[model samples]
Target: MPAVTVANPLALPRVPEPNPLTGTERPVVSVTTAPKGFEGEGFPVRRAFAGVDLRALDPFVHMDQMGEVEYAPGEPKGTPWHPHRGFETVTYMIDGEMAHSDSHGGGGLIGGGDTQWMTAGSGILHIETPPEHLVASGGLFHGIQLWVNLPRARKFAVPRYQDITSDRVALLSSADGGALVRVIAGEVGGHAGPGSTYTPITLVHATLAPGATLTLPWRPDFNALVYALGGAGTAGAERRPLRAGQLAVYGPGGALTVAADPKQDSRTTALDVFILGGEPIREPVAMYGPFVMNSRTELAQAFEDYQAGRLGSIPAAHAEVRAATPDAD
Candidate 1:
């Protein structure tokens, strides 16, 4: 796709001191494209990061679509009760409200600028419903749902949840006044996010201004990828336009550098992107439907548990949408 010029680039907040690391090893970087998400029947959700399957990215499995969509009044806009195992789902809302409820007694409504971090350890049932504002206004909805895999040791760990408002999360500014970086999982600069994670990873949501440029020091041991929510930019040798919902996975490098396309003079448009990096697990992964495990035997056991009504019920009544019937995509 051709580069889409940004009208206004958002300015970055002031940069803080760099993160202190004991070693000189830098994170590996790569640029990759996100494929369309949610292809199965009934579960008609669109995907952006893990297009074909969750295993493609190994340690980090998937990232769903990001953009604004209008849901008609009284329309059911949400995912019904689904099962997940061996991974965590992180939902960041940019607009609209989502009422989420799960099997672990975790339930709440997350509005614009809100986030939900769910660790579907072992197994759990969960669902999300659009709030009145979304249903009434043909609700404008935009956000990202990312999937992070658990290491072999943590695959069967107990489930957990963390609901955070935008204000509660740590925000980091760029030194060059290029962008505002929201640290969701790992440390950026001297600040770290409140969300507790099992792996040593970093997820940064950045907003950049038209002429701004930002560089992040990284550790080479970790694998990293970037997903653009809006605008266009060049990372190293790759010049790419990041439209809403598209993602770019960067190759292994010790640093990440991003700059707004200088030719695009529109100052009203800003660049919104996600920086995700973590240590890669050199282990086997077996995933079927919603459950992921280290082995097919474990996956089968999960299915058996669900069928035997062992997965347990969601703590509260989740706003229910019709259950999506399964099918081969």
Candidate 2:
């Protein structure tokens, strides 16, 4: 075997303290609903997922709220086949069922507590459609779709997928009922997630009961954001009641402390939240529709290749693209 050497772990970056956001502290940006495409239809929303644009997050690009919602019988709920390049999409399902199919030949139904990580390298086409049960029963379908940019070196590496079931993800509990931390990726309290990630990331799904508090250690080098799934809570010194469809951006600090309202006596009123923080790419991004590339020329070439069917080889259902020609890359 050739000599092997391990690469050094990426250095964690330092983040600054967040300015207190009082009633007067203006939000950096407001979260909004995504617009429908020319097709006149987009992701179905019986309950809307509030989306935050990635402009403030830099290379992070776009994020969509595919949260819990109800649908009536025979209602249409699905996203048609779409193409993407030079990026990745992470889908976390909280409730209901979703069926995913892609040109790469991979298809599966993700039920509650499932996560799908897809790397849309070079180019790939895929679709996420709602299951019949979800359409007929009109129950809650909660989830989030996060878009992460590919580094220039890996933009055309080849598409890959990592499907992680809820049971397989790591769950860490606080001894005093302070909090429950679900490790979706990276590490928390020495616990690591099973998801395959290209970048350094720490994704955690957390829940806090009434009057409970949880403190999380932080690495200054990472960019952090929190999405409130339901109920209300406060982070750091700021006491804010967050609801579903709301997102909180945290400034870099050594640690983060969260507390649930003790005034509420019902356990059902506890707060549900997702804490996702990752190392910042700190790079330029070029995005056009579903595709994200490092430069406009590379993006144009990707479009041309997809249009010519050069990237249409479906070797296997859910098959991963291992390698491709330079032109395709």
Which is the leading candidate under TM-score? 1
Q: State the lDDT at 272 in candidate 2.
A: 74
* Candidate 1 per-residue lDDT over residues 1-329, each given as its tens digit: 10212233234334444344432323223444555544322223446654433333657876675444555676535766777878888888876677877777778887677789988888777777676666676756677788888988998889888888777767667775467777767776557877788877888877777767767766566766777766777654345454544555565656666666655535327777777888888788886778767898998888788766577664434434444321111
When summed lDDT is taken over every stretch of 10 residues in candidate 2, the lowest stretch is 1-10
Predicted candidate 2 versus true structure: per-residue lDDT over 192-301, tens digit per residue: 88887787878888777678776666555666666666667665556555555566666656456666777553524767777777777766677777778877898788
In model 2, the runs with Cα more than 4 Å from the true position are 1-40, 44-59, 263-268, 313-329
In order, candidate lDDTs are 0.66, 0.64
Q: Give the TM-score of candidate 1.
A: 0.82
